[model samples]
Target chain A: MSEARKDDTILDVKNLQTVFFTNSGLFRAVDDVSFNVRRGETLAIVGESGCGKSVTALSVMRLVPDPPGRVVGGTVTLEGTDLLSLDEAEMRKIRGNRMSMIFQEPMTSLNPVMRIGDQITEVLRLHQEMTSREAWAKAVEMLRLVRIPEPDRRAQEYPHQLSGGMRQRAMIAMALACRPALLIADEPTTALDVTIQAQILALIVDLQKTLGTGLILITHDLGVVAQTAQRVIVMYAGKKVEEAAVEDLFENPKHPYTRGLMASMPAVISFGAKTDARLNEIPGMVPSLTNLPPGCAFAPRCSLAIDRCRAEYPPLQEVDGDHFAACWRAAELVGAP
Target chain B: MTDQRPLLEVTDLVKHYAVRGGVLRRRVGTVHAVDGVSFSVAKGETLGLVGESGCGKSTVARSVLRLVEPSSGAIKLNGTDITGLSKAEMRPHRRSMQIVFQDPFASLNPRMTAGDIVGEPLGVHGLATGRAQQERVAELFGQVGLRADQMKNYPHQFSGGQRQRICIARALALGPSLIVCDEPVSALDVSIQAQVINLLIDLQRKNDFSYLFIAHDLAVVAHISHRVAVMYLGRIVEIADKTELFANPRHPYTQALLASVPVADPKAKKLAPMIDGDVPSPINPPSGCAFHTRCRYVMDRCKVERPTLVKAGGQHEVACWLNDGTGRAENS
Candidate 1:
């Protein structure tokens, strides 16, 4: 664990700006987002839907299609090499070989006609130029690594033939086939049930420890993050609002938005018989990026919003130790319900 | 004191779909979707049905609602047998029982406004006419925490939470005594899920309505339900109070299911029992005990002889060979 913390940065995303060209206007789906994952640690990007968490992950991998989406600005550096500067062919080589991404929906991400073994072997053969026999053997090995039962029988089955949990396991197997240094998982267990979710999270954590892989886990479930992630990045409306150690974020959340999110979690401890126990809900919906307010994006909903909050955007400042919060009144907003 | 006169009583409810095969499309096998499941919901209590995916929890819900006709069973609503009633005959009782589906966006009619969606129930039941119907729809909107003026808005215009509220308002239009909520909050985000769960709790308190809340999330279910029932491959393996089910689960399957839920607090260490292998296919389920294949304490008797639901402790019942003391001599 100490060595993982000291390893060189595997991924450094700086000031990444992703925009969506809709009929309405150019919407900044990812606005000046920046984060980094250590060589063997997990950095979780936590946010609700439409909060640009997935958009930021997609931007890093350059998977966002160009017709309706485009990465207008950013420097995605892997081991000091600028990924954005690379050409399409070079980036393609780096994508599956260096930094693989496991998408949210395995049912759609997987090739319908291809066998599970062949799908993984295809990545190996395409990237490493391995023979069919070699790729198949490597594919089976990868499946076994993920702890998928009866790897041989499972490899012969098609994607549709496997269950949802098995398909997700298969997706993870494919992502880790090339021994990618950084694995970006976007809501990997969202479609799964609680029991299956626990298993998947444990598997990911175990694999990370064993393979010494850096992970960027993007999810809305705080429970998943609490168990797996070493650091947590809180996002809202295309902006990075808070970044801190997982324990710090849970124990002493500085940002009003983060506090509200933490309070809203229906834990067994917080709930009681009282029906009127008002949850700390940050009122109002997430503002549309097409028509974002000039000041702080969260000001419209934040309870701690003051005149300054409504007038100017706040820079991400270090609040306590290594904890960072992008709020105008981060100091004043203490012990928020 | 068991209430024999509960609002809804389901006895050995079973729903099996026949697998078609060969050129003639003959029934080769039966998929035991909801096999011999039983439970009762009192007047206003919420009996949460929770299990993993492919555990047949949803099938039990659909069977109880009569949405998907049960293959064989007894469904008694308010002491009246409603299971055998045909579609046309069940029309009168439809108002007293409603369902709030999982995906509100898909369940709602796209062409209809929010007002029409809620008002359709009243119109179908012939409970209101013209002006009276509009007033009732407005009232229903207010009950579900939606603004009455926004009745003209379409489903697409509302957010995910608001859309689900619309579904709830529609379900509550007829003042149903029981509303089967099937994974209502699973589709929403964490914050939004809290809002909807709170709303459901508040509404139930006000109306004294009974709910068959079915979801895969055990934490949410534990918070809302007074009693919880754990389901395996189309069977209620264990049924107990929420606290008991959480603290001292009897059956191995129930224990494993409860152990698997990840707590939000990282400091709290729980020994989660890992159940290896995927749920066996419903097409050809395990012979004796549906959960015997995955049960850590499987016995020889469990492979051949099925265990029926019997009283294990106070106000709790379990259908496992271990609990019945009929499996192995060693304690489970």
Candidate 2:
């Protein structure tokens, strides 16, 4: 079973550590993170802001700036090719062709001056060997594929003319224009309203299934993760504290932080189903990466922390089946609600 | 609980923005940001105004405080109409209300210390002076779960969650009866959001203050609100008890809003959008029902005749033709 899983894996990240040389000190943004994405599977990296989920996405795309930010360690292999080993030109080819990315804010991510048609077609013209006319036709098809209404007319319109949802559809059109093997969407629907977000997420899932493409959805919303992803990796203070199948992660969270996050979120519970009004708020804030604790990063806020938990960092270990958690007391918290 | 008077009452609230064009900057069109919306918040109760972006929830909050002058409306605070009051005359009314904005970083004065940020409101309202003000600020800090020693720290020195606590402390300083929480916890992380939300709930319990909570998120709204008013294209589509609204939303828009919320239960099936298409542009809003274009149960009458808010029993009400006691809105 493991061998079959390994064979089908499209992207594999191992012990990845990324650091930013800030004025204060060196901030380890992505601290020894590792995950795998199989073909046609949706893997979600869920965490709060500044928890290094975005940095991990950037690292995989090889888009991190070198002067301040650097991938200090680890290997990111896409289709059996180590991305870190590739040169700038080779990596550039892989960036848009084999993999694509969509950002949080659709308004700013899209080109303001350029028409939606030209932007999508430009990708086709660059990577795929297509003429202007063919690229234009493909661009309209791409927009149509994303379920944009009046694709023919919308293609001629500028980004500002289209609505927020329309702009996001256009962005997805550009990203999926080449039918990339891997699509990394970092908070694609965060700026969108829930109604619009539902549409975009549905569009993404439908398109992903139809195209059989691997997806790495980076977001802070567990709801989005539950709706889209098959597997989830929960991050905290730049560390992967929990990794499990989406259902397992939600049903039996083995990490204290993961449990705390699920309890903290007010969205998951139904209206009036809550016996208690006050959410079980995690007592403290995320630890500063620049000045991390000597032991577990989440020890200060965790209710399950013991002397060993505070004295040493726990390594990621499998507690149940494929459900992995980086906590000393993972065994005690197994099958936890 | 003995006081029967509503803390805040808004009636026929309308706020429009002019769309200027070309070199002359002539008023070309009008964007009806908040078009004839009305609601009430009882003392010690939270009236959650939930909607999509640009749906005028924030505008309603701002208009209630007289921060943005309403084009037309009656805003009665504790039986006093302050909507037509002058800036100077509104000062006293302002003391009875305050707002905690969405972005704590942008809302706070970076130059001022946490102490000054909380104390400035006290000084401006003349509630406290010098030594008394300092003491009040420290007490407020303690109430919000911030350390007294950290009162002198700058906004930038604190974390995102800490900054929001400071903003909350500042809002609480005036001893306002009504506090408008404008997405107070949206900017914070899940764990931190809980902390802030719980803090707000505790503060409300202790002080018996009301909140005009405006947020796009339904789940967060349901957490605190006693009653909820769903908005779409600057109109109140439905208003009901939190339990009823969330469990049995009558309006198609409200139903869609509830269904669209992605519950973090992966065991559940993948859900589709209950409604389709985008909310029509507020600048050129639809003629009859502003939500008719995207509404699933759109009818011919829904296209021409605007549906007014109709009672469906109890505190439940909806502004949809489908809920006209008929099973569904069908011209046939």
lDDT of each: 0.85, 0.89
C-alpha lDDT of residue B220 in model 1: 77
Q: For candidate 2, give the lDDT of residue A54.
A: 96
Q: Where does candidate 2 clash, by residue pair?
A: none
Residue B274, candidate 2: Cα error in Å is 1.5
For model 2 chain B, the run of ten residues with the poorest summed lDDT: B323-332
Instruction: Tell me the tens digit of each residue's lDDT in model 1 across B1-332.
Output: 14658999999898999999999999999898888888899998899898877778888878777888999999999988999898898887888888988998899998999999999989988999799999999998998888989999988999888999999999999999999999999888777887888889889879988999998887778778888898888888888887766766778877677667666666664525368777899899888988888878888988998888777778877888874542222223
lDDT of 2 by residue, B271-290 (tens): 69877788888999998988
* TM-score: model 1 vs. ground truth: 0.95
Q: What is the TM-score of chain B alone in each candidate?
A: 0.95, 0.96
DockQ comparisons of all candidates to the true complex: 0.43, 0.70
